[model samples]
Target: MRVTTQNGRVLLQNDVVNAAPVISTSELRGLGMESVAYIRAVEVEGEAGFAIHAADGTPMAVTEDRETAINAILQHEMMPVPLH
Candidate 1:
């Protein structure tokens, strides 16, 4: 629902969920480039979750599930624009 930087600076912060991803690290990383960090509020089987991904879709970490996942996502301090 919200996107912010690692330093707590917000970019495209929002209270509601986004139907589509703000950005996909997997696609960008495939181009042989790497930078920044990002996380997303994802849904699986109608459940809410979060995925911590590097600029290249390599998961740095992922939350357990539901609130735990959301909490973990909240801690993301995206170092670059990708994360925001």
Candidate 2:
């Protein structure tokens, strides 16, 4: 999934559809979901925002803050994958 930064923290892409943000940048450090190179839309309701699964479905993002969460299309690339 696309990744960006707010205050320098590595954040996951909001979403590419509807120009919405995947995760709220308000009181948080990066995304709670695992890391992915892409994003996807899921079928759900409020407080159950959309779902973004990683290539391997390992790193997924989910927000219960609002009814619907939409990520933007323009996004920044993530830093070179860090070596664990």
Candidate 3:
């Protein structure tokens, strides 16, 4: 995803998907706070795991398996965004 800002609004373009998702400042402020979650790799006491967090960076859950983490987010009716 390619992120850029225009007039204080954030623009996200996915090259592979060939789509642009626009988020205004107001919308950006609420991103991940609802309806969306993020997945990222983390180190848990020297063990690797996938950490799930709300869009606003609030910790939600952690799982040893990536697929499990994704499914958990989906089961919550949230869109899962994986961060590398």
Candidate 4:
């Protein structure tokens, strides 16, 4: 798995292709995932938004509301840290 950031958004790249994929950012957090995830406030398409990313810089999700974004991470039982 490869994780990187582009245009202030996190991007995750996986090499393996399978029909039944189980491992995911939400899954990782749901199982008390030990990986570090980051929540960053960003502007995409000229609009304000928030993005969730893994410790290695993999993009998880993005939302327009900060609270919604943070809450989503919390709901998954993961910590959401602000970027910068």
Alpha-carbon deviation at 33 in model 4, angstroms: 6.8
| Candidate 1 lDDT over residue span 6-75, tens digit each | 4443356666565543444445566533545566767757766677666666676656554554345456
Per-residue lDDT of candidate 3, residues 1-84 (tens digit): 678778976677676665655655457666545888898889999999999998768899999989999999999999987665
What lDDT score belongs to each candidate, Candidate 1 first? 0.55, 0.40, 0.82, 0.74
Total clashing pairs for each candidate: 2, 12, 1, 0
Stretches off by above 4 angstroms in model 3 are: 1-32
Reference-based lDDT, residue 22, model 2: 37
Itemize residue pairs with steric clashes in candidate 3: 32-55
Off by over 4 Å in 2: 1-35, 46-49, 63-84
Tens-digit per-residue lDDT, 18-45, candidate 4: 5344365555666654545688888999
Q: Which candidate is the best by TM-score?
A: 3
**Reference-based TM-score of each model:** 0.33, 0.25, 0.60, 0.53
Q: Which tens-of-lDDT digit does each residue in 1-84 have in candidate 2?
A: 677777766667654565644344333235422232344444465343545334334444554332222242113222112113
lDDT of 1 at 58: 68
